[model samples]
Target: MNPPSLSFRARARLSRSAGALLLATAGLASLAGCANYAGIRSDKQPLDVARIDTAQSLPTQGGQWPTMNWAADFGDTQLSSLIAEALANNPSIAEARARLDRAAAYAAGADARRYPRVDGHYSVKRELYSGNALYPEPYGGSWYTENNASLSASYELDLWGKNSAGLAQAISEQRASAAEEQESRLALATSVAQQYNALAREYALFDVAQAEARERQALGQISAARFSAGLDTQVETRVSDTQIATSNTLVSQLQGSITVMRYQLGALLGKGPDRGLAIARPQMQPLPVSALPDNVPANLLSRRPDIVAARWRIDAATQGVTIGKADFYPDINLSAAAGFDAFGFGHFLQFGSRQIQVGPAIDLPIFDAGALRARLKDRYATFDTAVATYNDTLVRALTEVATQIAQIRSIEQQQHDAQAAYDAAAKAYQLAVIRYQGGLSTQLQVLDADRALLQQRQTLVTLASQRRDQQIGLIKALGGGFDSAPPPRRDALDAMTSPT
Candidate 1:
């Protein structure tokens, strides 16, 4: 009455079919239990550079971008050398480089995750077998030496692109770090230049102060002669002596400022203050005509190191969002372990003592109590923040360039008037001195004209310094000669709305 038994081949085929059905059911269950990530996404949109208007602020004529050796253009070899030294030795640059190296290390680790991992382990121990345990006969209640050796391997199935996304995110971060390093270099260079320019201005002003003191001394001699001749009172001679003292005080103040400026330069060079003393006075060339490049905001994204760094951070955040979404799916890994084990060392290497294991491990986020959702939401928020930061940086960059341009134009107009005033004051001082020598004017009149001339000279010096400073500002605003390829036109919206 019993049914006929199936052949070996038929039994094997049925076993295969049953195994397939089981796997299919498990897969469906895993998919059904996946954490929900619906309705969570970044909302911010990056600003489109093409849409922003900059017609009035930027000049229409085409101009060249700043060269890599732009500091050399200032005609100060010392400035160029100082910038080179700062770039090499500055702590800020070193910190940025360290960040870049760390990011690269992280990227390498992520890349390693995409491939299979293998590990080997070996152990030796002395153990006691219990009589009530699985050990048989004399083996029970005996102490023996046990040996174990194993080689295990595992590979994650990135069906959800988790590992790949992580690698991409790390790469973006590395790129951002690199751009940040460049930014630090640019900042240091410009700072050194501005400080050097200030030192030069102080030196020029010091020369004028010394000249004024000499003129005051001469006037004092003349006033003394007039008093002796009974043509002027002691009051004029005392006034001339006070004027000379004031001029000398100004010279002393300038000397102190020059010393402090040198100290600052030495610090920028990553050396002692004495290094700055070795720095000769900067012989800055005439300011080049200020103009804008043919490309404005559109190309500025790539030209400016800060903006480029911001764009890379956006890419990194996008990848982070992708990684968060992937966390909602099942993490499947295939693992295999083969090893030899024996109660005693004598038989540990025997074929009969060998064992092997192979299986797929699944980690499904079935009941994480909304942890996965929270993480994904955080990622989306980070993405939104990055997009907003990038937009803000772009807007600020444009405004900076425009503000520098406007200031430069204003300075140009002032320089012309300043030159004329200086000429007129020089002529008036000459006439006053001539009249005083001819006894047609009082010594006070000559002193007044000299004061006016000194004022005009100082004004001209300040205007010239300001014009140079504005030129440097404009150069920095235009990206300080840094250049790179444009980032892809993707933004937060593209990342948030993409299919999970």
Candidate 2:
């Protein structure tokens, strides 16, 4: 369509209409920012299925995530000690704590912006005047200097809640930052647990390798003796040597694994990975037989710190929209200055010399074509992005819970099957050995049965280890019972105790 040309009055009317529309749009955008219509829907959809009752909650019991002491769950005192050390000295945790402090300070500053800013001032000077002075003049000059000092104070009245919105946004960001720090802590603790478990498994593997190597050495000696007596062939002796060599090679590989794990443990504890800390070999805990909670997936909203952080980000974005729209309206600020004024510093302390001033100032945007329009659009887009992010995080959290549940169930079945197989193969190996001694079975048959039994045993051990690790992962994913802790009442940023 072609644009229409207009007379002066018509253009003025059109401009006013356009301004009104822009202001209206900006106001709507602000509403959109403060309220997460999309997030509410998303949150509600899950709540219907999960039956979440936020209002009916009780205080956390003693075994809650924050209070439970996860290390104690494993019955490992050494693991507990290591975790304590990591919490105290880990660089990442320290950095996160510093950031929390910074965020809290920023929130405080934002809040204080709404209050009056007061300051004291003082000055002293000799006067020189170019023009004739009513009282006295030191010299006739083109320039004049005089001393006057006064204390001043100013305040911006948040008539439209703009300052309030700004403070709210800062507070939301502070909460988000705190949640992020807790997430980091959970990640750090999980890494330490996983690494410690890996080290234990490697140590077990090393022990297994050593035992196999000794067995192979004994078989090799027996074969050598038999060959010298002309009862075994040279090929049998060669096979025994090969077996011994393979077993020794495996032992060496396991030793290498032990060294690497030791270095990693050292690094995780914030010691130099290679040389700062001694590698104290820890006793591995037996696999936990505890059953997982049936309502694990439903508890994610309460447990996951990242999800909570995302929601706070959404709230902050919403408040940002409100603040942006408020900008398009007239700003009302109340400023006042009150101070003692005197010709000399000695009179500054006298109340009679004080001068007081007070007034309200209004800033009306007369002709900034579309600056506020553009800003409102930007805030709308940011709000949309925050909503999207929140939805995405919610989906991921659900998937995590489901995945851990499935993994744990599957590993349990695999462990059971592996145990049965190991038992059967062990019996077969015993029979084969007895037959070989009676010259009824070949050495190869005995070897095959023994290898099968070893394979089953190794698979069971690996599966058991994996099952334990998965349990730890599931607990970590569920925010490790940290959700049971009460939220902070203070505006100051506190250490986050959320899940990763």
Candidate 3:
């Protein structure tokens, strides 16, 4: 024990260890700094400069806009009027507009989250007191009332850009919804135009049927006269009567279809079925004489509203991941409260009653049994889904463009061939009628030729209408004319048009 006592100073020197601990702590802090910096940069990198360019090759470029005025594009005033009515009254449009309003309002609210929150409140309370203890002599209880008023304030400091991310996500969603509304508009316009074209074709067919019926009725009268004169058989008169009956039935069916079309048009304009909405038949405008562009798919991303909406979805998901990850870290917030409190109303504003406090509050997540981790996992999965959906939408959009292009071209050729057939059939029918009158061909053969002519004409009309419909489809698949709109303003329309 005497020998160990001599080593006290040496033992104290050997036990000193704070220098090593300081060095280790510094190294760990450096590593954390590097990790945090890397993460912030990573979050920012993915969102830089994400935009699509337009190409002259996209069919949407053929028109200045997605033909939001599709009916007017066809040069029909009646159709334009109907479209206007539909836009004003359609339930879907109204719903979309309301949703847009709500989104704008929410975006405004979200933006306000970045600012301090202030609230004023007043309260009144009554207290009952009993004095029966050793320090007091009173044995009765008395009630008292007090009133206090205060203004409190709270604000979360966006230390890690969490509030910014949330706001961005909300704004992006608003933009996507607006794009969806545009998509719906384009779809509705296409439907109206297509249905109008169909109605017109039906009318053309009706005209042909009525003409044929009139001719057949005249022929039936002649057959009846001939049969009475012993020149034609009852079987021939019956055949004429049967043809007339068939043509009359067809006319009736076509008339019913027209009525149905009128009802449909009225419904599109948000009117009751019996509103007697009149849809004047839209005659076919001449086929587009402009040259068609060939072989480009890149512009579909920029021109289509659905494509824009999908991209916005991806942006929103990306922002969501950021916000979720931020939750894993500490939340820095600033809160303040100021108020007046006193036992009497006269003393409420006194110096002793005045109170004010302000401070920063930090919330650190120490443990939640993996709750934050699971939420982060879910958000990442959601981001992945968004990415996949965006890619799929792009692929589908390209495919639609290609398919529509092919359809348009094929319909064009079909229209040409049908026109030739109609011309030849018309000439042949005329010649057959002349030949039959001159006793070179039978009346039955002339009737057959006339029917053939009508069929050929109807086929031509249908092919032409199909081409029109396909053109509209191609425009839609290519993303319409959103690009043609001026760049969005930063304030008023920002919530609607911005990628949040």
Error of 3 at 446 (Å): 2.4
lDDT of 2 by residue, 1-500 (tens): 11123459865776776576557545554453332222111111112324433222311222233333776677678887887788788999999999889989989999999888877665666655645655344445544333455666777757667899899989988988888787888888888888888887887777777877886686677668767877779998899888889989999998888888888888889888763247577676765554544454445555788877877777787677678756755565555555555655666556556665555555655446666657766776776676677678877776665576568779999988888898899899788867755557766886788678767867876887788788778767778655733232222111111101
TM-score of each: 0.93, 0.79, 0.80
The candidate with the higher TM-score, 1 or 3, is 1
Pick the winner on TM-score between candidates 1 and 2. 1
Deviation of model 1 at 380, angstroms? 0.8
lDDT of 1 by residue, 304-363 (tens): 999999999888888898999888777778787778889887898887777666666667
Q: After superposition, how far is residue 88 of candidate 3 from its true place, in Å?
A: 1.2
Model 2, residue 98: displacement in angstroms?
A: 2.3
Q: Local error of candidate 1 at 63, Å?
A: 1.5
Top candidate, metric lDDT? 1
Q: Which stretches of candidate 1 lie over 4 Å from their true place?
A: 1-26, 130-137
Overall local distance difference test of candidate 2: 0.68
Summed backbone clashes in each candidate are 0, 2, 3
